[model samples]
Target: MSLEIRSLEIRIAASTDADAACTVLRRSITECCDLDHKNDPAILDAWLGNKTPQMVANWFNSPTNFSLVAVSEGVVVGVALLTGAGKLALCYLLPEARGQGVGKALLARMEEQACSWGVKALQLHSTATGQEFFARRGYVDAGKVRSPYGVETVFFWKQLDAGAEAPDGGKRKRFCNCNPV
Candidate 1:
């Protein structure tokens, strides 16, 4: 059953969104990323060890990180984080939100944010489940590396046209209708 996202909002995550965003992050890893974790208790536990609400809140509040959440019908269905060093730190969506454009919207917004920040490129370690998604979005695979959780991950990077400036003069563009609230 596909979830028809009638009203989806992408916005900068606030402290109050930590709980729901954490839920999305955990659920996406546990449920949607079976290929990466393979239902192994040890790997799952290690990967999820620090995915607490408090940690998520800290990520949202960090000055060096930009966090965003995808809300559908007032529920956080997706979460993404971009580091100031041009790393695409986190990008995950609930299982039901897959193939629903939420990931694309989140990624587009992240790229826009990176460009606004004068980031020349965005880099990430994509799990098996996310490799194709990132590839389809123009990310080039650099090589494979074993994640800390023992999962084989692909390193991907995308060069951005950072020379382009937003109409508002270097501010992030609302490319995917994402609000920075």
Candidate 2:
């Protein structure tokens, strides 16, 4: 089945919006991200400690970072952050907001923003739940790395040049063989 949502707008996130954005990110990490933490309270605490509103505000104030928020009906549903060096810093959505094309839309908008800045590629670390999502979008798995929060994350990267197409004029390959748990 196809899911469609209305009134979804992606816009640059403002510093004043950091608290709301941080709340969404914290909730998403503490709730929907069990694929990595396995519902362990200690792990959740350690992870969420870094997702404070102040950190989000710092991201908002950073000159080299581009932050975007997805809003619907005046509520922030998702957020995407990227650095000028093409690092896909953060992409998070509330639990009820998942599997409804929010992340895909956010990623597309971020990619467009990066392309406008002449960025040729983007790289990110992903949880198991997010690995398949990124893979489906043509981000090839580069390997695994331990996150600062002590979770093993999959590293992925995708070239953003020429509309993500191969030089041979064929469609780009997707690494989406992962089965969702």
Candidate 3:
């Protein structure tokens, strides 16, 4: 039977999810990006070529940072994180789950957290492939940026309204993939 795409339940990740989130992240790097696990034998041998579990932990451990996990039918398929600098820490989806609005949901949640934290702008170092995605969502290009691995990453940022504070009574309603036009 085909799985019907429904609204994913997003919540603050627990400590147990730390490891799973790592796996999802590294795997996404291999699957989503064209970089091959076989290419550059030396690079493959090294750990933390781009992302690592410890990095994710450090991100989650930040006081002003917020990470959310997207679960549908009890399976975690997507992860996202927003930093105090308004940086988009980590946003990924399983290859099978792409284009089903899962990324939209994840991004919406990230924006929601940003608004709650009183963030004025959202910044990100995105891949060339991800530039269009961010651009479509109102993010403007800042310039070329280099990642730790020496890959050229594009910098993008989006302005947010300062008036919207975190909904004290009900925060979940603010995370409905409802982008302002």
* lDDT top scorer: 1
Writing each residue's lDDT as its tens digit, candidate 1 over 73-163 gives 9989899999999999999998898988999999999998987887777899999999999999878899999988788999998767534
Error of 3 at 98 (Å): 1.0
**Roughly what TM-score does model 2 have, to 2 decimal places?**
0.86
The predicted structure with the larger TM-score, 1 or 3, is 1
Q: In order, what lDDT does every prediction score?
A: 0.89, 0.84, 0.71
RMSD per prediction, one decimal?
A: 6.2, 6.7, 7.0
Model 2 segments more than 4 A misplaced = 1-4, 163-181
lDDT of 2: 0.84
lDDT of 1: 0.89
Tally clashing residue pairs in candidate 1: 0
Clashing pairs in 2: none
Query: For model 3, what is the C-alpha lDDT against the true structure?
Result: 0.71
Candidate 3 ranges with C-alpha deviation above 4 Å: 1-4, 35-55, 162-181
Question: Taking the tens digit of each residue's C-alpha lDDT, what string does model 2 give over 1-181?
Answer: 2224577888999998899899889988887889899988888888888788899999989999999998877888899999999999999997778887889989998888777787777899999879999999888899999998878899998876654567598855433222212
